[model samples]
Target: MAEMIKEPIENYGLSSKDRKKTLFSKIGIVGCGKEGSKIATVAATAGIEVVFLEISDDRIQQAFDRIGSELDMRIATWGLTESEKKTILGRIKGTLTFAAFKNCDFVIEAVRYDDNGERSLNHRKEIFHELENILAEDAIIATNASSVVITELASELKYKERCVCLHFVMMQPQSRILEIVRGLYTSDSCYNKVCQFAKLIGYDFVTVEESAGLISNRLFFILLNEACAILQEGLTTPIEIDSIIKVGLGQRQGVFCMADQMGIEKIVPQMEDLYKEFGSLKYKPSPLLLRLNRAKRWGVSTRIGFYEYDEEGNRIINENEKK
Candidate 1:
């Protein structure tokens, strides 16, 4: 696939006049997992008051620690002023209670995707119903669901018009693209506000219609699944498969390496769910993935996967390994 350079966010579907007029002050982020924590850190750094809510006390503390460490590293690596880092860190608050979200102008749900490999409409409805009881009447709700149908999730809520999918890539502060998926019932104001927020935070936004597995993940999983199948069929070694993609397709990383980075267990469940939902053979999980995940050999964090990481965090490939 060719790399398609995207138009600037300011030049996208939203108008500049509308962008300047949108409101964004207090924001709430639910789920302090990998992507959620990054979003909170970035939004806080952009001078938006941010409150992070997670299900458990442990997770909330983890988010706080992760954000603090990341900001400190960023300051040193990028030569950011100490005062600037202090201001950014000061703007963020972490909580385990939902009441903290009462004053938020916008809420972003970064919760786990359901067993269906999509943000279940029912799940969103449950949260929104509770939120409506506690939150201000007009607070907009956005989800960070990558593949779920946005319109479906929106329609399940009483405030359907104010709900949309604001899909951020894996690492929010580093990745350039942010997809604003407008649901069928999504209001123009909500859409424009999200577009404006994306621009303010230095991200390029693309407006996509409600679809299961929006552009990036849709294309990415299809390719990743194919690569898994090729490996499962014993057509080539993992190294050879990765080399082919990198050299022939101009990809920065190969499938096995990407899978290792993503965690084989994490992607397997989604692939299995997608296969069940879409009935596509391409969505089937590879046998190797199943075996590895079953063995609890999850990547980096677990210290084992396709390649072993040394004490210094270098990936050491096993030359004599063959299944």
Candidate 2:
């Protein structure tokens, strides 16, 4: 069945008071990949117009499809109605041109990692320049990276004070918490606006110092690396390790399972970045991760990583595994 479209509230029927002030009225997202799609959905769900840039027409359609599928999942779970999905979808627009970003109150640069899991700093800085040229001087520009790219990207901008970084938590649309990074050049007004934007989207923000891997990725890399080492040393199976983390540590998912969800492809490059920044062996990507990434096994995205998965992304158990 074709999805119905509804007129978004932001597009019409606003009172004179609402017309007087605009608070993040429009958000532009560069690179509508896995992470970008989620951010777009969140902002659009909050009734903000979301203009997302994709590389091509097909990629733009794919991003819309991904967002629709996620909404369908919520509909299936009774979290959203069909009408609400239509409203949210109506608020999102996909484009190939940065010209669509003009006049955007808030813009997020969320470039995806390449197939090899590497993202170039120079390329990201170029995107920063691109956004700065289009957005207003007071508009905020943020990157959706956990690494230390924010400060350097900000430094290249004419309005360096308006640049900040935000790291959305993995694995959910409604994650309540967001990690906010303030660059050295980021102004107090910019940081405060980002925090206000977070609250507008129903997320609480945490301030993190400028560092490679920021807060979540730094701690998560260590936990995932230790888990990988345990698997390498033959101390436990992937399933068992996950079980211990779930049952013993009371985590929602085991470290390995979450790693798979986040993609080994993305994780490995971040580990390399962190290692280069801090020169710590603990931040190094485990041998197992590199092997899997080299083999092109990108976890749930590819249906293979630490564990095999079927087409539906459900893990397939081995015959020898104990129930």
Candidate 3:
């Protein structure tokens, strides 16, 4: 039997201080949506060449524009020098084809549910197959999926050993914690490389079993779902619950506020998916969530999730606006 490699965190060589840096210059990011763009920006900032692959020219332009704005924000808020910001922005190139990933040392799939609410696993699988056909054999394939099983996705690929999951927290630039999950067939070398790369990019790495939702989202959504359930049951009002959790638990922000910041539309569907997969009572989507989603109140993006936002994107709460 092959020696079982424990979680990467337990291995000495894979420790943050001991892991070797790779010559990973070029990285390809598929689905330049929210998390995708953030991943691309971080890699680019670290001087890694980035090719952002999306389905359309409009999306490619939108991603580039978003990255540009983010780079500008980092310069102002994080005290990044103008030259440093320029170099970071210069490392990113947007493309509409998977062919651009040919020379990439790593390809990360950031595509999630489509606009039509269809999960695009097959579409992403096709992209992975195409990348495998074109990219170097040594290249690593990664997914940013929050709920999908990395092992299941890896099973469809030719290089299953080289494929793993690199789950980042919601706010990529600010959030330091990253969940690094290894599939059953993931090679030790590939796992080690990814662990090293996580440290290289300055994330606090936590190794998790290849479970759906991993650690952070799994625990987080449970709490969020419970908070939603309480609100739906009329046991407590949003503000009341927020006040209790903040004051009693010493939390900086309330659950609903954090949910609003995370975007309700994004969280609701994932909650539903998790319920379907796990059949856990706690995973059930709250009625309040279902109602809000039906009403198209999708949080900050839609300007009306748990709380309403003004035309200028400032969150506004009016007692009269309560549903």
Candidate 4:
């Protein structure tokens, strides 16, 4: 018998020529906490591969659990299918080392905020150094931090032109707006590429000056503070106030409800930062928020904030409201 003729693997299998080539194809996230995991899931759902780094295996697993739970909620609402969820989850990978980010052309640092809702600038600077050592010179570096000025972080890096800030207001998934801030040293090419990235992940982008709270948080925190003041004055309840905002102002949700979604712990600190930056009393965190933060009723993550939520994160309806 004649020997079998050699064949090209691409011909026998999927053709290499058919493979899609795109920038932002693979990205990395330095932290897999709440915001980090949300972006990871969103990117994976958009068909981009994601690699998220955590400090330990347990933390990585926790991030995975959180992402899965979010997808389950979408599935329950008919927004996602089981197979699509599987595919999205399959595209995300967790790691304990920055080395995993070496191949990522774009990496976002979405680390958890401390009790005060702030990440130490020194700590973030160190993270930038580690990423710079691993990634290519032209790779884009970004932070999902609304308060920290991108200019401050960029000043710490050798490739200062590659640094930018993307404040993702993840109050609701459908709230697909991204506040993209370019640092003083950020190059125009880097800014344009990041805009493309926002588009890739199915987000609309807004150019913002390097301010502590960008646009959304500045407006949101002030509105939330006023609502708290009204409650303190005994003028209205949270539910009633929410109704006014939703029905009257046409906001998708009330400020109190949106705050619960934002988590009290995260809210207080960011507000504190704004107050500290601008020295404005309006940006000061409300007493109610401080109490909630102290009590650790951190929104849906803890299943409670202004309202209570069930295991699936759905708010439990009060019996009185049932009438």
Candidate 5:
């Protein structure tokens, strides 16, 4: 299929007065990890200028390489052109500090997980405070957190109404829906602006209340936990289990496959956080997941999770799997 441009190409170099009328003309992404990079890519591809913050020069380059590689994937399928890739790259700038985000109209914090992919809530809170200092009072500040609540985080901000939570489902080619959470102090205008920005990026916004796990992740974790329990009982193999869900339940992808793609390391922390919040045994990270994480078998990124994957992120199948 040919590439689709949902709107007129934005002229990012317009004068300040003209730029002020543009919605989300400049986007800031804090911590260009997996989710952050995707958010940065989506904004830049949609003709918005994006400035992403990383901790060091090396990390900045790493983010650039990942984004470039992804764009190359689109180029391979003839969905994007080499020149278009360059233009997208040009729209995205990497910075080591929050100062570059000062002019950003909207800033989203997709803070990096630890080296082990474990989340640090305090670290995310610190990023929000730093963002508040760097951004204008009216600029929207968002967190790309699935299991973390936004209300407590926004409580520390001066313009608490500007704080919102945005969760982007990181599926391939990206999900068309954005899970948007409005905190207790989030203003109606602030929430409306974020919804408008989501539409600008070709996403349908699902307005959800402030809660741990929101809509997508909360429902997903429950299924993932159940899948883990079934697997633990040796009732079926991963392939067989996935096949049942794919064929019978009509799911595009099974729970284990989704978990693997999301990285076992990342899933554990989210499940743990959910468990802590709701005090539900169903939210507890499965022992099987814990074992895989401890073994450092983080899905496609690490080339192994519930199943093995090649460097190209394609699953490796045995010859018998062809049947």
Candidate 6:
């Protein structure tokens, strides 16, 4: 005989309705550009709710299109189902006001660069203050900053302890590791929570002291500059150098190729920031980068950089390699 069910209906719904809420169930992103879009996609893929703020409706639509296209590529390469893509896209929303982030557990500032190819620190600081006023005291405020220090951004916040640095490397998204930096006022609780956030989104985390460039930029910049120096010395073509690095050293992408993807205009300013911070020649921008920046060949966004690209952002390979 079949056993009679004795459990109440509430018992079945207990885990569904009464379970403890997740720490980062909902997150807010200040900008939805390349960096912000990557973070939004990652969080949404992990079943987290995401709301990103854009300057206008057009930008919001552009972000959605960019995210949708990225998901399409994943569908082709990673066997992600179209249904899964819809689910991921469904979890994300875009807004035009900071008030929309009122309920977000974590808010990350990833604003895009201005026309001058630089992000304004004043604007970021203002964003932090705006978020603090709207967000709960317990909610965290973070920046996807590379060269800027977290302490400076957190200095003006009422809840400075909640502000931290969370840098994501856009180059190697498959092996992307998070570099987390704790500010002068970052509490132990805040830092630990960020570490949990990293794991929640399927990333490995490294605890870093407050510093400009953190781990990713400081190391990557030197490698890139040295590679540029070799090119300057008439050593070899970019293809040859990339071949040796990829085949011999097992690098994921050629140094110059990575720079192109990163945008020469942005790289020069960041290099200058590092150089100013460390007072070292190693942190200085390469002359080649300066030339590219001056000429407005700012990488895939412009379809040109150290190498040329087609409209689809695929680098065009010519039989005669031209710098």
RMSD to native, candidate 4: 3.9
| Model 2 lDDT per residue over 1-323, tens place | 99999875766757464565587999999998989999999899999999999989999999999899999999999999999999999999999899999979899988888887777789888988988888888989999988756878877677899999999987433466899998889999999999999999998889988888878888888999899899999997998999998899988888877888889998998899889899999999999999999998889889998888998777888887744
Worst 10 residues of 4 by lDDT: 12-21
Give candidate 3 misplaced runs (Cα > 4 Å).
Answer: 1-22, 116-118, 171-173, 233-237, 243-252, 310-313, 317-323
Instruction: List model 1 lDDT by residue over 209-303, tens digit each.
Output: 77656677667678876777787788988788888988988777776776676666667776776777788877677677788888878766567
Q: Provide the TM-score for each candidate, comma-separated.
A: 0.79, 0.90, 0.84, 0.91, 0.90, 0.93
Tens digit of lDDT per residue, candidate 3, span 183-221? Answer: 899899998988888877777888888776777777878
Better of 1 and 6 by lDDT: 6
Model 6 over residues 259-310: C-alpha lDDT tens digits?
8888888888999999999899999988877888899999889998888899
Instruction: State the lDDT of candidate 4 residue by residue for 1-323, as single tens digits.
Output: 99999977776657767664479989999999879998998899999999999999999999999999999989999999999999999999999999999889999999887766568889998999999999989899999988888898889688899999998887765688899999999999999999998898889989999888889989899899999899999997888999999899988888877888888888888888889899999999989889999999988878998889998777888986688
Misplaced by over 4 Å in model 5 are 1-19, 171-173
**TM-score of candidate 4 on Cα atoms, chains taken together:** 0.91
Off by over 4 Å in 6: 1-20, 320-323
Q: What is candidate 5's lDDT per residue for 1-323, written digit by digit as tens?
A: 99977853456554454554577989999889888888988899999999999889999999999999989999999989999999999999999888999999899988877867766878889989999998888999999887778998888888999999988977435477898988899999999999899889888888888787788888888888888899999898888888888898987887788888888888888888888898999889989999998999889888998999998888999778887
Q: List the residue pairs that clash in candidate 2.
A: none
lDDT of 4 at 248: 97
- The global C-alpha lDDT for each of the candidates, from Candidate 1 onward, is 0.76, 0.88, 0.79, 0.89, 0.87, 0.90
Could you tell me the C-alpha RMSD of candidate 3 in Å? Answer: 10.0
Off by over 4 Å in 2: 1-19, 171-174, 318-323
Residue 91 in model 4: lDDT: 99
**Cα-lDDT of candidate 1:** 0.76
